[model samples]
Target: MGYHVVAMPYPGRGHINPLLNLSYLLVSKDDITVTFVLTEEWLALIGPVSGAPNIRLLSIPNVVPSERTRSADFIGFLNAVFTKMEAPFDRLLDQLGLPVSCIVADTFLPWMTTVGSRRNIPVVSLWTMAPSMFSVHYYFDLLAAHGHSPDDNLPERREEIIDYLPGVSSMRVADLPYPTVGRGGSTRKHVIEAFSVITKAQAILFTSFYELQPHVLNTLRANLPVPIYAAGPSIPFLSLKVPPSKPIASGAAAYFDWLDSQPEASVLYVSLGSFLSTSMEQMQELSMGLKASSVRYLWITRSEASSLQEACGEMGLIVPWCDQLKVLCHSSVAGFLTHCGWNSTMESIYAGVPMLTFPLFVDQYHNSKLIVEDWGIGLKLKQRVGEEYVIGREEIAETVKRLMDLNGNEGRELRKRAKELQETCQRAIKLGGSTDNNLNAFVRDVVQGQCNFAN
Candidate 1:
């Protein structure tokens, strides 16, 4: 009997992809078996699980509403996961013929701690965000005690500089995770409660690398009782030979062909992720801005912005979707205009593309800070006026022009830094690299029942 690991991700594309990548990496090792658990709906949508011999897919009932219907009601989905899914999950576990050795679960689904504890199985919590963002969640109690807990009405609190966290020189309160401020107090409390469960796990895995945030990682290790593993930028380790089970959006070949026709480092790629939606007003502003900038660009959006196609004239290609990774890797992609989702952040970093960040929500603000302030690899889109956040077409156009300016010193510098970080990300995932070594060690520790607090 080999190690039988049940990998459970929070039923979202961003969360599922990394866990699936980890499963693929694990099953590639000898004498390892991984069962990736997903909702039946997602499994069907994802098409198939293509991986090593030891990898398998399992689905539970999707009690929550479909993403299209629940796009605005994320809290309802979280409530469903918390209240409805456990019984089905347990029953499925009981029916499995193989004795499960351990469980790897998304950090957001903290109830996995209780499930693993009851079964006497070691649970590894996988945080699918940046370490800096995790640090804010991990230290939420301390922040609350210090009167820094976000209030719905207190917009001024965001500008206050946070000097307490280790290795972080000068991050503002604005740079902390989004739930801390934007969501109501109850949502904030819920997030804190969820993350609190991480302490109960035997180990915690981060989809980040030591090189990216060494100070934050070290701080977490010092503060947390369980072992912490930086096993990430997981996309690189993922086998590209096996194509994505489904195309993420549409016009896959046409987008690539369009890229082929453009000059090297000339096109800006814009995507705002799967879950977030933009207001029609914002969409119009973005469309007008792209037109005003006169930069050749590819914009992937889920909304009906067909009017923008004629508005953009010959300068832009507006598609519903494209293979994001493929588009990013294209020679013509000079910059990314993104919402700064962690997956997008990692992908952009890996692809060596500079960005014009227009972060919309949760953790994205922090990610933008890292890109613009910490990493110096991207420029921030100016959207704030006084305490209110607003982006006009002219502002967007100016930022776009600045990012795409090949002859400008700032644009050249951003690209140089982005490319350098891209190489670092590649090196971290390659054979014998930091992420590879950490992942291997984590797997070995789990199999041998030796995972414990690493001081």
Candidate 2:
């Protein structure tokens, strides 16, 4: 039998999608068997949505059901899995028909480290975000020692400046992810625990290109104990499979058609990713902004934000969920307005679209910094209160006009740079690219028992 590589993805669209893609990559190889273990909720989403063959799907009982899950519940649910599900997972592992050789797990799930330990299977932790963000989490220990913990009651203003990051320039505390800035000791404790488990991992895999974060990757490798693997532009890897059923409908089909109607590099695609919440007031401002810009747009509206469709109708098209990659690849999409999620960032980079970043929670702030400051492919907005917060009509109109204007030579340059990054990311995932090389070497050397883990 081929080597058995079991994967356990964190629950939610963000984590599950990338893990599924990676599993697909592993399964494509001649001598590999991928058994993807997911929660019941995730299985519902993946089984219905993806068409990954030669891969096995195994569902574990989610201690919490889908209806009870909120954005905040994710961490708690993972903690529960760590504490309560070990025996069940062990039972599953012991009963496997094939001999398990290695464990490829989410860095977010620290509990799996123990599973690998007990089985003598090398566990490689995958950080599915920018390496810059990993650097922040990996070094959060020093921050805690220097009084950056939630228990310290760090002043709101003091949290504004993240002056210590190596290549991240001009970052403020308010821009940091919620877990990093909050007084909730629970989140802080969880982050430390997660990274602690990560340190014991046999290797670290990042869903980022080495060229994108060269300096930060260097610093992280120096500090981290394991070999760091940059395996990314995962969307291209995932999109290789055509889903059994179309993930979007004919109504969504019109959105892409409209994209084709726009001039090359003229439309703005706005999506807040899969897991963000927007208040009515914020939604209204966004509507007015798009209306005033007179720029064509393709916007993704969630079930809750569906009400704002009427307000944004004339100049923009709103769809429930889109084939984001397909839309971004359209010649019409010039720039993206996003919540700065890592998956979204990577997708935008792969599509060569510049960004207008308004980050929400988790590594988003860090992703935004690298996009805006380091790569010069995007811009960040100052957070404002009251009516001005959600891209007021004037600001929206002005920003879009500027990004599209001939006088906006800088933006044109940025667009060129984004294209360059896109090419580099494409090469990084190709057969001879960095990520492909690492993945192949990993299977041969580590997963196939050619090398042993650290003592």
Candidate 3:
């Protein structure tokens, strides 16, 4: 009989996309059967999963409000995920015909660990962020011990350098994952509880390559109780041999057409993920910056920012969304202006595109730091202290010019490093590479019933 695995991702685009990619990879194995579970609302929003019949898409009723309704109230959504989703999730599992051999769930939903334990099923906690960020989360107790707990005066201490974390060097307190110093609230509590229960999982799966953060990954392997598997840069595992005839979505033709017209490595692609919304002032400033930079660009913005197109002049195109992976993979694209979400960061790395980071929230700050400092593949937009979090037009323009000016040493070096990292990312997914070996070993362990609770 085939090994039956069920995968559950947290209800966010960043979380869902990586898990879906992982499901696709797992189903490629002949003796594996995979089921991807999500809330009905989210399922409808994301549409269908296009894959072999061994991979099934299933959904439970979203007992709480949809992402559209609760966009402003993140805590409300977290509370619902913690309190409301469990019963329905349990029911879904109980009704499944195939005896579930294992469960793979996002680290955000720790309650799933309890459910899996109760059912005597091994749960592999899949962390969708960079392993460096996971190291930060795993060491929350150390943060508290070092007088950097969430209860501290965060704004005042934002500039403090955190050099004490094992395997991490010269990191600022401000760049630590947001939850480390977040204000006291239900969200903070939920995050703390989530990390605490992660140890209960039979094994931990990171959507990162071992080489991307070798020191941090090594530290985690030595200290963590469970087996740690580096199984990713998961996006590349989903790549196809032939390019799609058109972009995945209908309205992206004009944008891709514009890309087709641009010279190789000349355009900067800008996107800030799906959930973040910038203020009008920031949006206008960004528009002015792009206009002033004199470089070809393609930007994705919400309908609210539609008016800013007047400022962009003929410099670039602005669309609501497009096939990001396709755009990044294009020859015309050079650099990315990003909010430093891990998903975007990995995609950029995969495409060998350098970045200009303007991190908005959560782990983005850390991801930005990694891109700019650790990996040497990007630069950060400037932010002034005690001022409203905004990048002025001049600073944005300067940063863009510095990145795109191929004659300049900085730009050349950044692109060189980005290309090197891209080769590393590609190698990791190929047969006998680190990620391939890790993933195969993990699957074999699970199939052989070798995974067990660490404690």
Which candidate gets the maximum TM-score versus the true structure? 3
Tell me the lDDT of candidate 2.
Answer: 0.73
Q: Which residue pairs come into collision in candidate 2?
A: 159-173, 160-172, 160-173, 161-173
**Comparing candidate 2 with candidate 3, which one achieves the higher TM-score?**
3
**Candidate order by lDDT, highest to lowest?**
3, 1, 2
Clashes of each: 0, 4, 0
Taking all chains together, each candidate's TM-score versus the true structure is 0.93, 0.90, 0.95
In Å, residue 343's CA in model 3 sits off its true spot by 0.6
Candidate 2 lDDT tens digits, 243-298: 42433436665776677668888888889877756667677777788788778888
Overall local distance difference test of candidate 3:
0.83
Q: After superposition, how far is residue 242 of candidate 3 from its true place, in Å?
A: 3.7
284-359 per-residue lDDT for model 1 (tens digits):
8889999999999999886775887778889799888777877898789999999899988989999999988888
Report the poorest 10 consecutive residues by lDDT, candidate 3. 178-187
Q: How far is 249's C-alpha from truth in model 1 (Å)?
A: 15
How much is 182 displaced in model 3, in angstroms?
10
Checking candidate 3 for backbone clashes, the offending pairs are none
List lDDT for all candidates, in order: 0.81, 0.73, 0.83
Question: Which segments of candidate 3 are over 4 A away from where they belong?
Answer: 150-153, 179-186, 247-251, 384-387, 451-455
